[model samples]
Target: MAEPSLKRLQYFIALAEHGKFQLAADAVNISQPALSAELKRLEDFVGKPLFHRSPVTKLTAAGEALLPYAKSAVGAAHRFNEYAAAVNTGAPTSISIGTVATFLHRGLPQTITDFSAAHPDILVTTEEATSAAQSDMLLGHDIDIACGHMPLQHPGVICTPAARESFWLCAPTGSPITTIAEAVDSPFVIFRKSASPIYHDTVVGICRTHGFEPQIHHRTASWSAAVEMVAHGLGVSLVPSPVARNYHGDERLIFTRIGTRPNAPQAWITVRREDQSTLIGDLALGLVIASEALADPVAD
Candidate 1:
């Protein structure tokens, strides 16, 4: 037997919803006779009577059984049409983004603001995740794009450098610590390696390069928390310059340039290779451009 057309399924669903022939016809933008004929044809195709044809319209056993399936089919058809329309018009429908907490403070907020203004039709969703988690989310299709440090090199993932954020020495105000070497012996606050391996390694590598390992007295998951620890004299810490610049509390923390560790890690944007032509690509490109424009230059 031939399959039912989407028009027939739509008409059936409308009739089921309205329970009145005239209302159903109007809902489907068809004449009452035309709707009646189509519904009759549908019942014939199903090999059963669909409606009781009484003053109060009601579905028969077969009609009740087919109602849910017809609704699902019609809904799927409508979604397919919407998807096709969006594709033809080059309009983005939705974008799911994942980024590290540090990037959110760095330049991501402005990037999102600008991207939203530019593509208001696209619904944007953002989640804060670590680099590894973001990579996993991207690979699993949980998110369309990600921003974090050193994006993973997976078979269908493409990574691009978005911005560079320099690390700064955060110390309590009035402390004698002027450089990484000065804080070599001081208690150090470090990033939890599990949360941010790149940052942890960078801090450790910097300390090791200075002829001593950091006396790690405290560890935290976020730059803000590390800065807070420093402000409270818990320990000196290394923080990204952007985080320092954007920090809102505890003016007693001093952010100093680490001359020897001037090379900053490249913040990377990652996306699935297949999403390069979609709205995900547009969002990534816009974020990169916006981040570059808003990035603060390191002081000499």
Candidate 2:
């Protein structure tokens, strides 16, 4: 057996995760033919079939066996490279992050804490902003990175996906709803559009996908407020997995998977294209790791 290059292992992992040659190729920024060839080479190296190719792909037993090891290798390689970058460059005295309210509530704080530990001398600051304001702030160089929900357009800004967040259903306990469609007639609560338009649009869009427009009766100023309103029987809400995971101390609130399962939404970090450097990559990597930590599916 021959050791496969890290690129091939990465391609294997992406194909396994994304479940389609084209989609996985797009995710890893390679052509579909190239991805297919690389995956075939990887299988040849391992001397076993990995994926059962179809419209929707599934991992063969060999692929399942390799998945965890592949992920561990990739993570270790990333950390090594980050460490090398840190050693080769001048460490800045301060770095700042701007993010939407939801992430600030959940993932961003932990990322900041961990990154701060890694470089104890650096001053870290965070601000909560709407998705659009985040982009503007990045362009103005007011913040090193802008973290928010996607469709982050600005030719001068580069958007890197942080993590994919599944939306979970939040409803008051004892409500008759077990599925999102069951709560279609119930009032829906969302973050106010002005404060967090991405969240507001995501909730409305999810309801529309399940065969009706949401009767959005309440718009709260914060992510917690939306969950609080749902807990009080004011309405039901569809929130990202992080918010669902963190704010469940209230026994009146129920957090579970959306029965219809809207496509997972992506959170991204945008930087001014001109500001490419090792420090930005470090910031983005820490955030990606933290946000992905929050991406696990909520238990039923």
Question: TM-scores of all models?
Answer: 0.67, 0.63
Off by over 4 Å in 2: 1-92, 298-300
Residue clash pairs of candidate 1: none
lDDT of 2 by residue, 1-300 (tens): 678988998899888878888889999999999999988989998899999986568999999877766765675576457547667895445567888776764478878888888878677888888777776556545577888876567666677776656788888999888788788798888878877666677788888888899888888877778887888889898887778778767688887687443454557877756555666667777787777776755432
lDDT of 1 by residue, 1-300 (tens): 677898998889888889999999999899999999988888888899999887679898888877756765564455467669889997667778898776776567877787889889887889988787786567646677888877578667688877665677889988999887798789999989988777888888878877998999899887878888888889899876677777645569777776643365557888878778877787888777766665557653
Q: Tell me the spans in candidate 1 whose CA falls farther than 4 Å from its real position.
A: 1-92, 260-266, 294-300
Candidate No. with top lDDT: 1
Worst 10 residues of 1 by lDDT: 257-266
Best by TM-score: 1
Cα lDDT of model 1 overall? 0.78
